[model samples]
Target: MSSNEEEKLLSYNGEVLIFQLSQGDLAKEGTAKTCRLRVRRMTFNRSTSTFIQKSTGIFSMHGEYSGFEMICCSCAADFRTGINLPCVVIRRNKKKSVFKYFLLLLHSSNEFEQRMNFTLDYEMKDDIKILNGPSILWRHNRTSFYISSQNDTIVSAPVEFSSIKWAGEVENLGTILFGVGEPHSTNRESSERSSKSDYAVWGTEFYAYSVESQKILSGSYFLPHAYGSVVTCIHICATKVVNTVLRISLIALTQKNQLIWFQDGIPKNLCQLPFQDPCALQVMASDGGDLLYIVSFRSSDVCAIWKKNFQVASKWQKVKSVLVDDFVGTGTEQLLLDFKDTFNTDCLTSFKITDLVDVNYSNDAFDPMENDLFEHNLQENYSLTVQALERRLQIGLTNIQELQKHLLLKERVLSKSCKALVGLVQGKAYIPPYEEKDILVSLCGEKKQLPHSLKEKSSDTYHDSEHVIEKMWYRVLEDHLVVGVEIKNSFLSFLNDVTLSLLMDQVCTSNPPIIQCKNSVIKLDKVSFPATLSSPCETESVAKRIKLTLHNKERKNSFHDQSSDANCIQVFTVVTALSPLLAFHNFCCIVMLHARWGENSGRFGETCTVPCGKLSLSIEDISSGKYSVTLPEKNKPLKEPMEDLCTLLAVFHKFCFQITSPDCTLTSVKIWLLRHMECETVKEFPDSFLCKSLGALNGTLFSWKQKSPFEGILTVY
Candidate 1:
């Protein structure tokens, strides 16, 4: 019905006059036989102006007794013809006892009743209100309800309440919220919550209570998810039956286009269906009995639509999978219960073709004359057929090949990028090679710490001038080695010339010669050198003996004294230091000495020393320790602003680094100040640079603070 008509029905919120009459008595209107009618006046929407349609007969009363009859009434639209309202007649039964009357009537405070336990019988009047008990108002797709109550004051409140008696068993359930208005506005308040997309589910429970003391009466959990699963195919079976039973039947096409029944839930397995080429399916119910319809195309020459009785599903031996086209279109076809239907190669068995033929050409008028017409028809028929055949033969191979090629290209790009990154990290191109330079060579040796198997052999004993041997050893002194390197060009020049040249310049540029006194020897023609070295610096007051040791003493000694006094003459030389400039060299200058021959003169005649350079150094120990700078008191004179700021920055940097650094060691800050001195490159950092650095540090510090594991216990301020 239209909204106007529905609104008119709702406006009649007043007493409703319901009457029950019999059909037999109403047919004899002219006769003296009066039908008994039971009339009960209950409140209804007084504003309604539409004709009321009810399924059951109404009840009312005759002159003196209750009569059941059909009443005839004329409507404005059909005024000329007589239309009747089917009703029943009711009368008072006086013989029934008071106790029996009391047992039949039940009342509540919300209801308007003239009398319930009175001695006299009650009669219906125009303005007198009677309780309607309960009823349903509206229903919809998701939520539905049946309002139930013991009584309703229809005269004033006029609330249409639902009664349990009106609500039949689940099998006899009907629509309840059919005409209900939208509960309230469901406008979204904000975009964030709107994205959630909230939707209403079915609420099965409904009750009537005072606004002050609301209480839950009766409720049930409704399955809304199940309803949403197959919303498009919802069907309501309205035919009534004696016993209520909900029989549901579902017919659906599987992902593989196979016909299947959704027996328990959704069809999850395709093997359960018999048909391999299903076309369409539908579901229907009558008298609480459900049926499934399935259509299938079996090869190009056959098609059928089959009906399966859902009530007999368990008893079915072999459900027929029907192919529909054979019986639908005009063709030279044959019907069979078992593989009998067939069509020619013209595709007369396709349901789509049959439907097209039915819609375009209702009558059989075969034309075989025009060539253009035949070509057009042939093109229409063969286009889809050839395309389908080609697609099946290719089987999506082109798409699969394209995807593989895309993945291969991605892998190649990733591999190339990874290799480039590795090369960059290992100093492949950015770091220039170190240029070779002349370095002073001084070999200083000490006694070997190895077992007897690796000891050095004794030199040949000869009565030679001890003071003379020391003079020949001057070439192996540490100072002479430094002077030699200063003269020759080395790869270290490039290291000192690079961007970080200042760090390399920190090492002492030059050193004085190292004087070697007492007995010592030198060998310039040796092929191999020793591993251990011993040498005395200039600070040592007394001259000591130089020792020579070998890894394998069983072999011949590789050293030879240059002169008879080689052991006596003092030797002066220089050795390369462990500075970054000379860090790349693989050789170390060393000085050697021999065992003393007497208290003043050295023994064992002569000795030599050799030392090799180490490849790497670690600064882990240098970064940890307590470091502090004591400032003069406030009363005392102040230092330059740059000096103060530098000291503060250095201290702060060390502390912040400790907190943020992954490899920081915990130590007092004061020790750090003692080890490294701050050189004032400038008086102070410019305000811009200082502010930028401070901001960056502050942001980093804040991030670290937020993520700190000991956030609450430790404060950064």
Candidate 2:
């Protein structure tokens, strides 16, 4: 054969016919009676003329004959007696032309034919192509056969059957559907008299094998009637039944050994049928095998078809029903139905599969209960999410509050530390050093008592002659100065009065000095002595002998009360005033005191000179009163005695005086002597001999003469 002819034969799209030559036909044709399959290719020639003929003409074309060619022909022992019903199992591998073919053969004898006469076998290896793996077959007798790639047999033990009557394999489900026959009756008399028709019955129980569990599960349902008791045939598509819409039929034996029919492994009565008794039950499934079309024979000339629509709920709905003639044909895109009557009247119609099946169902078909359940679950999830967020928020707030409290405590500690640091820098705060002794004992002693006044003085007398300033102290604090003076007196004479004064000299040469005074003058003669001390004289004489008292003196009369006995009387005074230290960089403080004595009447009634003294105070020495200044020598004469005496008399009514030289060589001395005696020798004794003699004399005789002349040359004799 040419390559083109071989290719055309192999690629033929039309059906190839298989013929079995009988012994008589083979003898008559004088040929080998081999069963074989053949293909006949047809071809036509087209006219190539392009010219248009204006005149009408008859066109004729001849067809060439393409004789039948042998494609798949076999003469093996299995096909020697001719094959029975055969099924082709296409291999899943598209690249291979190998296939598994199963053949059911019946070897019948008169007696065994009424019983089990069928033998089923399959062939996987051929001269054309080889199968790579094993093929498995499980039979109704509980035996499993495995044919390996080497064609070796692997036989397993018998498995127990869940039902007594084995129907057949449900090819779509890859499981065997079985049935249980009804129980036998015990009445032998009724059974013996009954006709053969009375023995026919239907199976009561059914089951289908579960591939996953390797067990049989129930698939039984009730039946309607038993008029046609035995099942004549069964047709099931190799499509798995997922929804209730698809259908399958099988034949089984009853308990009495009678045959019966089962649809979908269940009794026909329990199934929801579209029509009562379907003369022709045609089940057309969708490409996806989810929908089923059950076409029933309605009348002799009319047919009705019901389409079962599958839903998401795993339930089916009879969505469409239509009537047409008993003619059905399927094309790629349309279904052709040719209706013909008994009288030969014919009509044709075509429908799209989508239209016949009612592909678009109403919205009401969705289960409302399921939607409500879904919403409920969604709400529950949302609530849980909200609650979780709230819990997290609460925890966050708690942590924040704790952090705030911690921050506040830290701030307080920082503030206290800052205050302590400030105190140390300013020097206003003091902390005592730690000591071994009790703190209370160390704090005791002479404390600095607050001074109510600026200055205070107190005096005490120990003996009748001695006088001493016991305590004299001052403090300069802030803007005020406080001076304290205490005096001790022990003189034997009466004290007429006492005067205390503070003299401040400005350090600047241009400013004048300031003097502040407080006087305690004796204005009364009543003197009060302490009861604890015994006077040197009797109590009655004490009052008469010493009449010391106190009185404030005006500033103008500050020098008028200098009559106290300086050695006997004591004065205590406090002076408080605003300090001059704030305004002056340096200043001098002099404490001046004056004491006067009364005359002693019993001893010639001589009155003593008034006593006065001054104390200079330094800023450092004021607190302790331990400084002293020496008095100038009394024998030293003043450079200008007359001027010095006049200034001294102006400040104090009674002040200490010291005369140095009485020699006549110092002319000022002669002049001072004349002035002391209130004798103006130059003027009163002018041109007199005494004045000249005194003025001219410069030796010791001159000093004596000067004094004698002042005495008025007293002792004449």
Candidate 3:
């Protein structure tokens, strides 16, 4: 959406913003079945109900024309479609207007939300019309929306907007305003009752009114309008806006009753539009004064092409409604005509804005406060509360800005100090006395989270061309990597020209680092690029995979031949260091295994050196675990009730439990297979060849061939 080409709708006078509706591809012939294409989208938007005059954000949101997203959703069916609509965004667009593509957003009349702490970097000099953030321009990304000044357009009497005055809690910010009744009788008999200063009682949202249009007033409210404010410019909120703010899902009316709302018995003007719910009901303005912008909720992109398709010379005739449904008992054509009339610019002239310098809301309150002081009270000295609070606010704001500047300066100094420290440490530690700025850059910042874990980020991209074979068992004691080749092409059973290479994606060698591969080893004082790790070309063979499965019909064992899968796999592992433990350095390493497959290609297959994909492992995995790891496999099949008993105090401190099979196996380890450390200690392990979830022994086995002779389960809680 190119907002750079701006053409506002509300800003202009007579210019109508014609929305261009995109046509759906569900094309059908004349004999096709008719179905309604209605879509309802709901998003939970939580907002703090605070009314402080903090900055309200208003940023430009764009539609599909500018920032369309591809949706690959799955339900009963795999539906891969391109929905031409904008995503629900929190920030503004960088290059286009918010409404550039279309206004597909749920517009709320409670629009002034002071949430985001941001500034527009400009001075405001008005009663503040635009929300304090990036401007939400009413721009059409497709066909530029049309606009006309009030000069060339004819101005008619604006819709009458009789502003209401309230008392009590909700005097300032009127929470709920009902206008579903006719104006009170203006006769002399009812003059005192129908006067503007009369009290307007409020009711609960679920209140049941009597025939007299009155309900038992309940609840207390503190109106934000307590400070008093006159309507500056009365502009009717769009239907979508009002429904969204009020969260009105449904609005049904009977034949006898018209959709009229009342504020203190004052009738409100509204368009007679047929809709499924309140969301489609138009909140019409009764009157207006000068020409101003109209807040339109409908986006220009998906609106009907209703730009006076017929001749404008003939009384501006209303076209037959193209709606798919009827309105009440009458045709929808007339209702649609009334809907367009709601946006008529001719009603701008009646928008008269008047200020209430001094308002007496005594009679308007259900319980009006009595005036206790006389005129002399105004002459006495008093405490200025709001002024003092404002001063305190100024001090806090001043401190925040000053502290932020100071932090920025200190951050710069810290960066310089880190570099100097890295230089000094390298000179003292390096054996060859080399200089590598990038290597030592990580001296100050090393990943501490997920100490030694590394894994692939995304699914493997290489399909049948997988040539990298991992050697994990060789380093199984120190490494946790357990993955193999995923090959599909079974015919090519051998890999040739295999080259095992290593590349350090990260280096934190403030201390000299050592690199080891196979029988080769090298200690480096500094780091360089394109390092080698066992760069010897070798060959590996793949075999056909076979799986045993029971025949569904025969109930007998059957062999399922997986010809595409490779059974024999070549594995490899890489350690970050040659220390006592595994990789402990906060670093990233990319292992590139290049190999050639299939050489007899004269007529069968081609011998090509294909990339086996690059695997970049980094110690960047973080785990913000909230709780300790639960008992390994306990409760997997539901918790087992422990049955322990102590016979007597004579043999106290001795707990006993009868074990039938213990559901474990006692496997003996060969003496020659044990390491020097393992041989020195007792290698007596518990029943290890058994499911721990089932049961272990007096204590379950933890590690295989360990020095610790006893095994115990340490439950956290």
Q: Which residue segments of model 1 deviate by more than 4 Å?
A: 1-135, 139-168, 171-717
Q: Provide TM-scores for the models.
A: 0.16, 0.21, 0.17
Query: What lDDT is reached at residue 1 by model 1?
Result: 19
User: What's the lDDT for residue 82 in model 3?
Assistant: 22
Measured by TM-score, how close is model 2 to the native structure?
0.21
Candidate 2 lDDT tens digits, 505-529: 4444322233453343211111222
lDDT for 457 in candidate 2 is 29
Instruction: State the lDDT of candidate 1 residue by residue for 1-717, as single tens digits.
Output: 121110000111222233333322433544333432233333211122112332222222233222222211110111112221111112233333211111011111222221122222333221111112222112223223222222321111122232211111223332221111112233345323433212221111223222112222221111122122112211222323344432333344333433334432333222223434543343322222323342333442222323432222211112222222223123322121122223322111111111211111111124323333544687788977998989876877888889899988766544444333233323253222233112211121224311122233322111121211212111111111121111011111111211100011112322212222222111111111221122212111221122222432222243332223222211122223222112112222223222212222234422322111112212111111112123333233224433233333322322233342222211211111112221111222211012112223321111011122111111221
Candidate 3, backbone clash total: 39
The parts of candidate 2 lying over 4 Å away from their true place are: 1-31, 39-173, 178-280, 285-304, 308-717
* TM-score winner, 2 or 3: 2
Q: How far does residue 385 in candidate 2 sit from its true spot (Å)?
A: 51
- What does the lDDT read for residue 574 in candidate 2? 30
Better of 1 and 2 by lDDT: 2
Model 3, span 1-717: residue lDDT tens? 122222111100111111111222222442222211112221111121111121222333222223222111111101123221211212222234332111122122213222212222222221211111111111111111111111112111111113211111122222222212112323445645543423121111111111112222211111111111211112122222243232112221212111322222222322221321211122211112111111121221111111112111111123211111111122211111211233333211111111111111111123323221321243342354667878999999999999999998766545544444334333333222244333333322222211111113222223223322322111111122211222223322454443434433335543222234432111111111111111212111111111222322122223122222232222322323222111332333334343444443233322232223333332222111111111234223212111000001111122333221122111122221122112221112121111233332312222122211111221110
